[model samples]
Target: MRGFAQLLSGFLLEYVPRRRSLSENTAKSYRDSFAILLRWLADGRGIAPDDVRIEDLSRENVESFCLWLSDVRGVCAATVNVRLCALRSFASYVSFTEPAYLEWASALRAVEFSKSPSGEVEWLPVEAVNLIMESASSDAREHAMLGLLYDSGARVSEIANARRCDLRLDAPATIRLSGKGRKVRIVPLCDQVAGMASAYLAATAGAPDSPLFVNRSGKAIGRAGITYVLKKHVAAAHEADPLVVPPTTHPHALRHSKAVHLVEADVNIIYIRDFMGHSSVKTTEIYAKISSKSRQKAVEKAAANLIMGSAYGEEDKSAIMEWLRNLL
Candidate 1:
């Protein structure tokens, strides 16, 4: 049985030998994506890569594959979408390279994929943030770690890999994060976050190029460390409340809260994109729903305030009180 690579090499060598290499990153992405696809085809569908006919990727097969990803693998929608995208690439490849398979590839157009909702991220209220920040340990590390998330709105991967060199602490402070696909984006730090991070950096005992964040074990902070830091502080804050609220903590919520705060402040949407390292504005659209809800609440509060201060303020209130008394 021939491997998928062998088939591709044979076909390309026999026919389109003149095809130049695509961009290194693109070729790598395609290779990685398609390789997983071929493996899935052989293992899951019981079809050898060489024997995988164009019809192997029929609409039924595509739907079954998505189900298998969720049921068998327990993957989330975003992860499933990545694999589906790989299939689309294969379909696109088949369309041009193998005329016979064009219909099979085109049939993939009928397959529907559920997109992840933009509301996946939940931001806490600004009032709640004050409690969380205040709950941080006296340790500068804790302060800086928590502050950095709000200041940078960075993904977890970027935070784990953050280094001192990434910071540019002049006016309009910035830190560079190496994001997905090794893309670099500079996220400006607010003055408070910048100052906290600088103090933490100065207090840390490590090499200049060592991890910017460390845990109790004296190692660089990882996902678990980040979670631990957030949960403990959040629980403490929740316990301190006179209301005795239930503890609800999510790491990404801090990042989301930052985005929402900026949007509410009317920051330029494009600047938010650049700051957040969002490759597409669609990725940044998560705030639309949140902002709209907030706007409605603000308008309602403003209307209440206006009525309280208006000429009919007393008369209208008296009428409402009379109606309430009658109902009672």
Candidate 2:
């Protein structure tokens, strides 16, 4: 019992952060999975979290928990898969401590990740993004943050962790964004975005180490803060032009919009992949697939430039037809 407590505490406190050095979001996800499992064990099995022995974490318990997540909590397949992944990771760690449970860890790991339904990638139109940016012009911080999200196509986490030192507003301005799995990438900023960032920073007058975007309390803006700014402006843009901005507009939609716009501009997909900090071109290809405007343009171009029949002359066509007739 004491050993189980030590294992859970050490895994969450030391192993995940110190050994794996995962991002805060990733750590929270792992912690959340354990918390949910603890709650389920207490509620469903009448077992307290700390009182549970290592033997209690059986293969049956894991599968039961997965079903509870889907049937009781009503979580999506992707979310269920995420919790399963966290459980599998913990099970593997347990194997290292208790060699006797090697088979148990293997059984838990054998559980398959559920398949999720494919859906169209949601992205805003150019006019919609423009309207949202215009709506945010009243607040320089919001404007700059929105512009940066669109221009750089950074994930919300990357934007939240941005610092004043990350910006380089000289000629050929760029910002360094740290993405998932601690991968850092340099994204070039457009002139408009660069100017906005410059003005906002100058007004804020923070040290290089200070957060780039702060809330009303002068504390660093979090993911929720960024989402709030985006949602507020999206509503305003919709009010101004109801048809332009969609109700589903989000900060990540700005990232998607930027990628789709780049694809529409005939930019090389590889460059877009690098610019967006995607690990693979396959991930970047979703934007090209979702760019209906670009696809329509391609169809129109092909239709407008149709060649009038084959280049063969009438005599050549006749001779071919005669040869075919004779052979028949």
Candidate 3:
């Protein structure tokens, strides 16, 4: 255990470049999975940090741990899979260098990734988005955050870690976002989002080195702080009365809603691709699923074409008619 963690950590740090390293989201995810696995081994097997051995995790234990995570802990399978992958990567690293667990590494490689996914979380419903956006208090940090999320389609963590210098005041209002893999992408900011961000920047324009948004003490925005703002004000803004039950919402749902809205507007896939800064055009393709209304409009436009052979010459029409008759 002593050698495993320390060695793996050192190697990963060496391999993953500081500036071009794993995306912030990926780092967070790997950390979470490693924590869970370390806890399970320590508590369940009574293995000390120094005494732990990779071979201690029998093939059966690896599979069992995954199932235990999903069933007992109430975690979704996708989450369980993520943890397994992280552990596997660490195990592979150990196997290559330690030689003590070469066979264990082979066993680890035998484990197959899940093919079919489970647990489908629907994006924010139309009404829910309206409720959440309207829930924010006017002229405040939360309100500005809500507008930024909807308008920019940024992740919660991104918004939480945004800096004062990230905003580009130039035309088209592009924002320089440090995405996953330390990959920086420039996302164009809409006028409304830019206006709100400008206001926020102005209010807290303390230093270029400072955070774009802060709390009372001028500290960087924390996850819980942003969640509190969203739950209290943003979602509540959706209700007819702020005191009443407001829109129940989640961070990703708002992003999904924004994508769906763009899809509905017939925005080109490539355009949305750039706006969302997705790693691949394939990921953005999901949004192209047409709504019933859009489908209906498509049918309406093609309705004239349904009058088969109308544009053909009378003889050609007769030939098409004959072909149709023969098929009948």
Q: Please give the TM-score that candidate 1 achieves against the real structure.
A: 0.55
Superior by TM-score: candidate 1 or candidate 3: 1
Model 1: ten consecutive residues of lowest lDDT? 14-23
TM-score of each: 0.55, 0.55, 0.49
Every model: Cα RMSD to truth? 20.8, 19.8, 19.7
lDDT of residue 45 for candidate 3: 75
Q: Model 3: runs farther than 4 Å from truth?
A: 1-121, 125-131, 241-246, 290-328
Q: Residues 1-328, candidate 1, lDDT per residue (tens digit)? A: 4334554554334322224333343344445555666688889878887787656778888888888877787765645655565566556655666666667778896676545456455676776677778888486888888888877988877888887777778888888899989999888788988888888878877776778887678777898888888888877775454122125566887888888988888898888888888888887777856787766655554555557557666777667555544532
Q: Worst lDDT window (10 residues) for model 3?
A: 238-247
Cα lDDT tens digits, model 3, 89-117, are 66776776678778887898676544324
Q: Report the number of clashing residue pairs per model.
A: 0, 0, 7
Taking all chains together, the TM-score of candidate 3 against the true structure is 0.49
